[model samples]
Target: MNFDPQTLRYDERGLIPAIAQDAENGDVLMMAWMNADAVARTLQTRRVTYWSRSRQAFWVKGESSGHVQHLVDMRVDCDRDCLLVLVDQTGPACHTNRRSCFYTALRDGAEVEIMAPVADPD
Candidate 1:
């Protein structure tokens, strides 16, 4: 079956939420926004690309930092409004050097940091 990027549901800004997950361990890495073009670029290049809402431009993962996310697979949600990107993540996925962006946990009505940042490379 042929897949089309336009077939996916987008928000009013023509953007969709894309969640990056570790392909081998099944850990969720990060969540970002993507336009249709960003989605196409990621698929074509095997590199994760996102639309930076604050930067108002296309953001390629690991472009600036060395923490590259190589696309392993891309999945669409049942509602077609979200995406799950399985990737071979190199280094820390979070900008803070954490393995995943979901570092904080709300437990017993208290917020706690569940993960620590990885050590910097030499």
Candidate 2:
């Protein structure tokens, strides 16, 4: 059967958590929120789109940052409440220029930064 964006479960704000992963190496890039429209838009355009809770608007990845996330696949969780977006990521996924937003590691009751930011092209 065909898929429908509306069929997925959403929270009270009509938003679902979406996790972006690198399709090539399986690194989790980031997590963001997506409304139904954002989901549909990402599928239609093959560019990842997210609903910014702070900005309250739709953002097409790499629209300004050049760190584009080209959609490779989109998977729904068994509960239908979460999404996994497999993508071909370009540049650093994190705004801080790291490969992932989850840069800090909590080990032995201590927090440590495991990853360093990538050097800017310019």
Candidate 3:
């Protein structure tokens, strides 16, 4: 059976949550929103694409920062409201230059910085 992006449950805004994970190590990279069109584009191009609510546009990973996410696999949750995108991630996934967006950890009721920002290559 062919998978359909429309089959997935979307919110009122026609958006679904997509989580990016490192294909090699199973590390979760980041989470973003995606519309049906973004899903189709990601599958078609083998590059992860997201819907930027702030920009109200299609955000192709690594388009500007060179931190591209090449799709390895895409999975839908049991509820069909979320997506898991296994990808070969290049460079830091976080906009702050961290390896992941989830850089802060809540430990014992205190927030801790577990990871530091990546230094620019230049």
Q: For each candidate, what is the lDDT?
A: 0.95, 0.96, 0.95
Supply candidate 1's per-residue lDDT for 86.
100
* C-alpha lDDT (0 to 100) for residue 17 of candidate 1: 99
lDDT of 1 at 101: 98
lDDT digits (tens) for residues 1-122 of candidate 2? 25689999999999999999999999999999999999999999999999999999998988999999999999999999999999999999999999999999999999999999998777
lDDT of 1 by residue, 1-122 (tens): 25679999999999999999999999999999999989999999999999999999999999999799999999999999999999999999999999999999999999999999998878
Cα TM-score of candidate 1 = 0.96
Q: After superposition, how far is residue 11 of candidate 1 from its true place, in Å?
A: 0.4
Clashing pairs in 1: none
Kindly report which residue pairs in candidate 2 clash with one another.
none
- Clashes per candidate (backbone, < 3 Å): 0, 0, 0
- Superposition error at 97 for model 3 (Å): 0.5
User: TM-scores of all models?
Assistant: 0.96, 0.96, 0.95
Candidate 2 error regions (>4 Å): none
Cα-based lDDT at residue 59, candidate 1: 94
The CA root-mean-square deviation of candidate 1, after full C-alpha superposition on the true structure, stands at 1.3
Q: Which regions of candidate 3 fall more than 4 Å away from where they truly are?
A: none
- Candidate 1's clash total is 0
